[model samples]
Target chain A: MSHGDTIPLHPSSQSDIDEIENLINASVHQSVPSARPPSPPRASIPVSVSAPSPSPFVPSNLPKSSSSAVPPPPPPPTGFGPAPNTLTEPVWDTVKRDLSRIVSNLKLVVFPNPYREDPGKALRDWDLWGPFFFIVFLGLTLSWSASVKKSEVFAVAFALLAAGAVILTLNVLLLGGHIIFFQSLSLLGYCLFPLDVGALICMLKDNVIVKVVVVCVTLAWSSWAAYPFMSSAVNPRRKALALYPVFLMYVSVGFLIIAID
Target chain B: MDPNQPEVENYANPKTCFFHVLFKASALAFYILSALFIDNFVIIFVVTVLLAALDFWVVKNVSGRILVGLRWWNEINDLGESVWKFECLDHESLARMNKKDSWLFWWTLYITAVAWIVLAIFSLIRLQADYLLVVGVCLTLSIANIVGFTKCKKDAKKQIQQFASQTIASRFSSTLQSAFSVV
Candidate 1:
């Protein structure tokens, strides 16, 4: 029977025609045509009936049998993107690891690399919590020793954070540094490490000489620590300019802690 | 892949997110209120320590892993030496990590650490030996979380280096073999 005549007789849907064509194509391509003769319905159908319009039966988009045998599945996704590890671990495990890293950072064995492209990785290594907490504790201790009120202590802390944010923002906007805001904050926060120690020492020692020595040492430490980071973050020509804000930031934090009454 | 557990994407669901923030914030708020409003220092110390421990647990297991896909644990080997194990989200997964969850994790982590250290220093100045004990525990817990993730970062670096080296080595060996066969 002609293909068009069979379409009305068997009620074969377009999908069925497509599947039959695929089977015939597969058999022909596999060199096993006699194994399953192309269904009479498909062979008799004209290319036009199954080609353009889907009128209950037909298939289009034929593959070149010689080369396109079994089209490959769609390529798997590519590129290394930021993806969280799929590890579902208990919390205690993470705590232990964090403790070890805290000690390592405190020993100054590893510094957070502000140059890291991944903000998360750089911030993670910086252990901002350890240094930030230590600095806050020391800052509060200094304020308390000086008999500063709690409200004043809050004011100073907020002012320091706000100032650091402003300086870092300015660096990003004007200097064109690609520093992530939080990562920059983390780096600047660590710059206070020396001042924290200085505060602690000045608190313990009543001698004017010791306090002065500690202040000088801390100023140098904070400046030196910040110089490398700030320089690398900004344009080479603008390194010196970038360092100015960091220098100012550190000095202000120290001044806030010491000058508060 | 249990139907019950949250899908990878849903791990950062609003409910978990809410609980995560609530637990950590409430722990600190409760401790501060107890320390400030409560008259009995003994009660204050006990409550604060307990609350801090609770926060430590919550941050470590819940927010730490779910929010950032990082976790760690301490184990003692046969020799009684302590060994640390860290797990972190793969980079591909990290790429899909929720930004808000990360923001909450890092900020809260930094603030929590600072709070504990401040309390610890306060106790030291006041010469309150009992309060120091609590401070010590809280500090240790906080440090553990930070240290675990730092080491995880290091491990990831090491793994990448190793994989690169292996690939290069295999390519070199294959090249040598092919050249020899050609000869």
Candidate 2:
């Protein structure tokens, strides 16, 4: 312990210790996945080489570094190499992990009822991204179809959708059924997938009847998908109570989709 | 909700709990005071109603849930029947709520309603029929919130009773079934 403690006394070893501490923080605490091999052993070689120098080196380095209140310059060789490697690799890995998580969530929501498999596990990892994407995408398409003030149309549509989701969640919750706040929000957004798909198709076509039929079908699909979970939230007496607002909002959105042209 | 259970006088958030009363009191004060300063009837009506509406929203959505562990709403069902719904934290959490917060919430709620009613009576006596409309709207909202929350507390009690009975019934049935199977 004494021999190890004596090394930090040397001025050159002081800078080296700071660099090693940074490296340790970056490696262990950061939890980054790097393509490059572990480089800390190579970084520590210089520190070991400087350790055996005289105690006189210690006082000279301490005063200069303490006054500056900044870490000394990292050593020349391996410092520049690993810095770039750390940034790029883990970023791509994180993106892949998050994207896959979003995709799995979408499947759980958009496909059929997966909650039947394990009710506890359903929506265990709810996120706002799916809701945000669905709401914004629906708003943008409706705006494109608007004859005038597309921006106002987008704002109104976005606000309505967002507020509708919150109010609907509160409605179910107040009816005495157990529900997670964000999970319901996420589920509500996913229920809009059918409507979103219908919106995409309707925006391309001009026939009023075609838009009506498509909107009606998609609206029913959205409401049907949302019904089981929302109805189950309240007592049997209040099942219809909790679900009406949900269908009402979906109906309004469908009407907006059909009537936009 | 046992009467014998220890009362929790301490608040989970003692410092900020006053803000609930602060908001309701300010909303009421604004509505009552705005008439004396402002000449425009439309401005008073609109702004006061807006403030009341904001308070209703906050009390319904945020404060009731946080301060007293209750939530309530009314909605129109498919057959055009209006349904009033109420939810509360189960008995344990309700018992754990701060005594001071509940006192403030219930007292402030009833006082606000009473104040609006008095204002309504004063308007009636003074023959200021126009202002009565504003007071009436505000009073209706205030009372609606109280009714909903009152029903919620009762509903929570009913649920506890039902749950206890149901658990006992199920356990008894299971034991009888096992005994019959052995025989």
Candidate 3:
């Protein structure tokens, strides 16, 4: 008979429909009942035997009927299992679920960019090189402020020379034989002997006074060294390291002041 | 959420403000006392250093405690929310998870309170007599802060439980609807 022409079963003759409805009603009744009476001993035996029969019957459909059939062949173990396209749909669904979860949990607010990890780059961006150089020059000019008494001038000159030497040493150590070495050395000479010939400036300077001069000069030099660290590009670790010299100068001054007192 | 973002609106806890004010008052007292009565430079310097050391300790301790408190508060808040979410997702699991989180929150809060009380007593003993008035003010403020925090904690707990129950009901309804649709 054609599919549409099939006769509908009468209620009296529909044993399958009756069985299904009875089964469903029994399930609903069992679910509603809180206390379930224990099954009779013989009734449990059939249930226990039937439970595993379906699973065993599924494997029996395979061709092998011998003892060797106990070891099932691995699914295409020699070849690449599946293409990306085959798994993509399920993976995409999982990703979509996770993304949706993240979206729901996240606050939809945007904030300004936070502080940079490096600060030295900021200093560089501001072009503070001129100020740094001016500070060095200012330190040298301080000597000119002193009265031209033979001893006072000598002390000032000595201090300037000491400062210059310290700067030169730092530049050399930090830059390591770069072309800037000669330029720094020349700047050092100009700082130490501004008006007079270089040899005579050094010959008459007292060693004790020169040491004091060196301390002041070293302080100025270290301050200049720290200027580059003010840049936003400078990493905190490097900035911290660069700050050590300035700290050392402060400590040294503290000791000197204490000794003098 | 970006993990780097700082979650708390204020880094300094209200409780910390009290300690800071006390420390500052003590510092001012120390300075005035040294200037008026203690003329010896060495003695003044030593006293200053000692006071500074004590101040540092107070700030460090208070800051540490506040940070711990803030972290725990956040955890509890988050846990409360999570419990609610879990309940909505699966009511069968809610009882177990809720009990675990409640126990954890209570334990952390209790331990923190005990630690704070110990620290408070220690601070009271260590602080100078001239600045005892400031310390008393700090203690009063701290007590107020504790009371406020307790109220907030209790409210949060109740709100979270209610939120979870509501969520579960809604989710359960939706699940039933979908099951009915398929059937």
Indicate which candidate wins on DockQ: 1
iRMS, candidate 3, in Å: value is: 27.2
Give residue B25's lDDT in candidate 1 (0 to 100): 68
Question: Candidate 2 — what's its lDDT?
Answer: 0.62
TM-score, candidate number 3? 0.23
Looking at model 3, residue A88 earns an lDDT score of 18
* Tens-place lDDT digits, model 3, residues A1-261: 122332322233444333333433344344312321232211110000000111121122221101112222111111111222211123345346434533332211011112544312221112112222332333323333333333233333334444544563364346332212222332333222212221222234535465455545544543443333332223444555434543454334323322221
In the range A1-261, model 2's lDDT, one tens digit per residue, is 122333332254354444443443344333222422232321111111111111121212321111121222222222222332211123245347547868987887566573474442445556556776788689878888888867567657866897899999998878877776777888889888889999998999988898999999899888877876776667889888888999999999999998886
- Could you tell me the lDDT of residue A92 within candidate 1? 58
State the lDDT of candidate 1 residue by residue for A1-261, as single tens digits.
Answer: 123323321143454443343443343334323322233211110100111111111012111101111222111112222222324545456668667866765443134344555322233344446544654565456555666355345334634564565577577558786454544665566667777888777767777767777777797787775665567667878777777777776677666545544
| Per-candidate fnat, comma-separated | 0.06, 0.00, 0.00
For residues B21-130, write the lDDT of model 1, one tens digit per residue.
67556656766676678755434544555566556666666776677656664433333233455555443344345655665666666677788789788989998665
Ranking under lDDT, best-scoring first?
Answer: 2, 1, 3
> What is the C-alpha lDDT profile of model 2 across B1-183, one tens digit per residue?
334422543555554366666666776787778777866554565556656765675577666766766676543233323345565554434544565566666667788889989989998998875577668767977998888777765565555444434333443454555558669
What stretches of model 2 exceed 4 Å from their correct place? Answer: A1-89, A114-121, B1-183
Q: Lowest summed lDDT over 10 consecutive residues: which window, candidate 1 chain B?
A: B1-10
User: Can you tell me the CAPRI class of model 1?
Assistant: incorrect
True contacts kept of 2: 0.00
RMSD of each: 20.4, 23.2, 27.3
